[model samples]
Target: MGQAGGGASQAQEPTGLNKLQHIRRRCTCLLPLAGWLMTCAVHAQSAPTQSDFGGAGLLQTPTARMADEGEVAFTASRTSPYTRYNFTLQPLPWLESAFRYLNIANVPYGIVPNSNSQSYKDKSIDVKVRLWPETHYLPAFSVGIRDLGGTGLFSSEYVVGNKRFGSMDASLGLAWGYMGNRGDIANPLDVLSDKFKIRPGGFSGTGGNFNTSHYFRGRPAFFGGISYQTAWQPLILKLEYEGNNYKHEPFKNNQPQRTPINVGAVYRLNRGVDLSLALERGRVAMFGFTLHTNLAESPGPTKLLDPPPPVRTQTPPTQTPQQVDWSAVSTELRSNAGIEVSKITRRGREVLVTGEQQRYFYPAKALGRTARVLDNQLGADIDWYTVVATREGMPIVATSVHRQRFDDLLDYNIDLSTFRRSVEQDTPLPQREEVLYRATPKKFDGGFSLGFSESLGGPDAFVLYQVSADYDANYHFTPNLWWSGGFSANLLNNYDKFKYDAPSNLPRVRTYVREYLTSSRITMPTFQLTTSRQLGTDLYGLAYAGMLESMYGGVGGEVLYRPMGERWAIGADVNWVKQRGFDQDFSFRQYHVATGQVTGYFNLGYKDVTLALSAGRYLAGDWGTTIDVSREFRNGVRMGAYATFTNVSAAQFGEGSFDKGIYISIPFDLMLPSSHVRSANIMWQPLLRDGGARLNKRYTLYDLTSDRDSDLFQDNLQQITE
Candidate 1:
């Protein structure tokens, strides 16, 4: 990271002249080529390594495991040398994305009067879709796109790789991009009249013009590399070669640009933790640390069985040894032949009773039936036995029998009140009342922001103003989902004016009429019920639907991936908005718009010298797009540049007329000592050229965290959820 020091000086100027002069004095050479060579050299030397300041996690393990049996991994770094930190989240098995913030500290203010006042602004976001996974010798592949904020469209790589051999793995990649026809010029004349054209000897309409489109078309770039991961060690080494070709009129000088070779290494400590370092000339030596936590672990594993052990038992015993009945004892000695039977033994003697009739003896049979009944009720097999002895001390006889049955014996008479009480006591109780207090006033969470821009080029200078805002909130009536509501508004106003000088030194015809001053705005209020489920660690999939403006509503879904670390996030939303048109000329249209954004932020250094950047791009209806980059310096100093482009071909706006412009601003924090005070920032915004009428720059001071009564503060307070 670069240190913050000194005001605007000769050393800070970005020019080929200074670079050439420095090189010529040191080594005999012209400056432009030398500067280009120096840039490449710097890039080569400062290439990312596992141990560089922000190169951590260069060779980390896969973020998520495969449900089937395959592995996928992805890693990325910012393209600019000034970038300080980059991070990504890949919670889903198939998707990957990242966000990066570059540190361009101390961009000089007052460069073009009101134009260069903004301070500290840098940001970028990237998203990649894996198209194929490696199988055997085949390599994995992916298609990705990056939004460098104001820098324009950056396509991503299609990677192919081979299995690691010893300490080495080889890979190849290809990328392509179409740079948006957008840029800022130091001098307005370069983009104005033919006299100031870039090609001095060329005919009319040969060079720069504000209205003339400079589409870059699509340009392909290629890169290849060989990386080595040492066996049984934590070290990984890599070398890469990359080049690109731009096929566009605006970037004619950058055709066949060859990037310097990069060399770096990564060190891994565990599955989701690693350290990295990298170096590139003119860029800072970067070092970074990364730790990934799986969200799948949050909910824990699932259980397949409920109400565990069922009750059952063996049959009960049915019989026991018995003695003969006294009344029947006299009949047991009789034989079937009608003769009286008599027996005598040493252990027993025959029994005789008066007035007894002769009868044969038979064992009692009721014991067996009782035993069978007991076995059937108890679901168990049981044995029954019976024994009889004579009254005169004769020997006894015994018999045993077994019984079995299949039946439920145990009664399920559980106490419901007792079970309910146990559950109520064990489960955690939710907070009945939550104290809500204001934690210092904050900026607006959602509101309309109006901005105006002027075109300094051409015989005509034009001014444009834009207003955009969105209101969103959620109410949780249940623990699982929420009632979501949102409102959006957008407006744009454009005015054109121009003045030219004639050849005779007299004032040329001045056209002051507003050539095509138009404005359009839309207001939409929506209500939806949303429910989301965890798809991975820090990742979720949500579906929602409800009435919109009391007219129409349609179902939609979205996927959001937030890495364990808060530095980066990516999401995709698809909605089918339906509305019936009004009977009059101004009627509503039913349509659907898909939108997605990847966002991220990171600190460049420690303490008062730190720099931070945040970047993002939004894709919406009719290919409408917005890019923002912001950088902040220590002591609350910040600078930012933003560009918004819209191709409203599908809307009422025709193809020939579209809206596009850029806004740059610098803001500084002014702290004061007071009990109810926090901090405040002052912003400087200048209109480059306002419809042939240039106005003085404007400076505004506002509370950093707005006061309770402030519009920003009220908006944020209402957005708060309990």
Candidate 2:
């Protein structure tokens, strides 16, 4: 026995050690995972944390916390390389204030000096207050002020809005700001005496003490607008008018004041993001991002007081001690039966009327009781004639006659009861059957396109052909969010044959420039993760981050506000994009610009025809520092005219002078039904030159090519060309 016990003890020793080793390995593997899960749990819990009422209530409507209800919320966002901080406070149920700050350090600087200047800073501060809550016939109202502080200039605006119908909201507002206008004079001698003029107040007759002095003033401006919102999608349409007038003292020139009418539309691509286009004096396009925080909880429905209970009473028997009919008791009973029957009939009618009145007054509580009484009364009237019969010697007979003249009364009640039952059961016949119509989903939206663009009087002109195919799919992972992706490929061919005559008056020769004839094919595969939410009836906001090929990555946000019933809307957006290049052969570099735009749109209807106008400005970018206007027909089909005017200098080939132009474009959409194909649009743009000394003198062929020749010959050539 001792020997066996010794062997067993030895066997159990290794088993114990093996078990310990297994447990240790498991702990080693699971420790880090558990820690990671705990970290994630903490972040998830902390990220969307909310305060109740007065910093202690659950966050509800993002705008609510901004209004008074003693609710306050804080939300933060990061789009790597940029971080934003948002804070909201609610002092009243109808009032709110939101503050936002955005900072980016990797903003791109382009080839031009000011095109991508390091000092290109952008910032805005806005405050909004609700004026009135919604009413049955009146719209909700609100007012706001926006202060835009940026690199070049600063401006402020006051805005007002009204909610219309049950789901639409509209707004109108005015703004005024000062823009610095500096002149470029090659020779100061032209404006100075002996190149050193010192006027009484200053060298330039301005009230400054120095020669190189600065003059500044704020120009008065005003604008009015209206807008609408819809629920089908986050769609906002807006229309407005903006104008300003100013004068330059030293130049003694009056700037052409603009009274630009504008229209625009914005569709939320997702929560925190949107796509927008507008036309004013020129065309403005924008992609933006937005962040929202609920400041208070939305109020629940109002409560109503309960109705008073009904009073109850008993009626004493009306019949009193009267003459006894003992001799003919049976006959008397029969005669009296008729009076009883009549009394029952009158009581039943009174009961029905009382029940109906109760139902009308307290529908919820009385409906069931009324139904039960009606059923009981109906049953009593139907069976009132029931009686027992005795068989006579030869045949069945009414032995005692039952002495109940109430039989006729019962029969009459039964007949009336049947009629009433039929009447009650009969309802209005349905005129039509209900139908459910479902929209069919499209799978592919792909096509090839061709386009031609030219400058009427510039050295560059091109006829381009492009073949492209696109596919877009939206997958819903939840009720309020979707994941969308699209792919497209485009091939471009440029024709650049030019005919020019030599200065010696030789015959014109046709030559093709290699740089102009270069063709490129670009394939863009795009993907996006988006989330969207409805603000109220017609207001919504979206935020999105997307990638287009390996070169372009973008993040932005947008907001749309549409009043319930109108066809106008207002939208605003802010966005940032970073585009990288792969190589010289495939790279086209542009300045990294952060832009904000506020647009308004109007839809004028005439039978089947609709006309639209849009206007807005690119608030931060140097490329589109102008007002854009366009008139669209048939929802972007057919021909439309557009114009763009800018104060920024043009591209180098145009001698870097300020540029402006108007053009007419014809757009056609081709739709096919065989595949998942939606539609494709082809646009043809014919240039229209603006007639002005500045534009005409800026890029004259002689001026561009003049440095290669003598001044006298250049002037002669310029005269001949003109």
Highest lDDT model number? 1
Q: lDDT tens string, model 1, 1-722?
A: 11011100011001010000100011111222223222222111112232121221122111111121011122333333223454444323444444443443343222133433333233334445566665676665555544322233232223333343445555554433332111212223344544332312111111112212211122334455666766756677766554333333221323332334555666765554455565432133445554332322211112122111222235443332122232222122221111122221111111111111111111111222222222333211222211221111111111222221112111223332322221110111122322111122111233333222222222222122222354555565433356655444444333322222111111111111122112224433346576655455444566666643323345666565544323344555555644323221124444433333332222223221111121222222334443433333221222232333444321222111222221111110111111111111211111111111100001000110001011221212211110
**Which candidate number would show the highest TM-score if scored against the true structure?**
1
TM-score for candidate 1, residues paired by index? 0.30
TM values, all candidates: 0.30, 0.27
Query: How many clashes does the backbone of model 2 have?
Result: 71
Give the per-residue lDDT of model 2 (tens digit) for 582-668.
Answer: 321334346344544454543343211122222233322333323223222222212122223333322211221222222111111
Residue 119 in candidate 1 has what lDDT?
33
lDDT of 2 at 323: 26
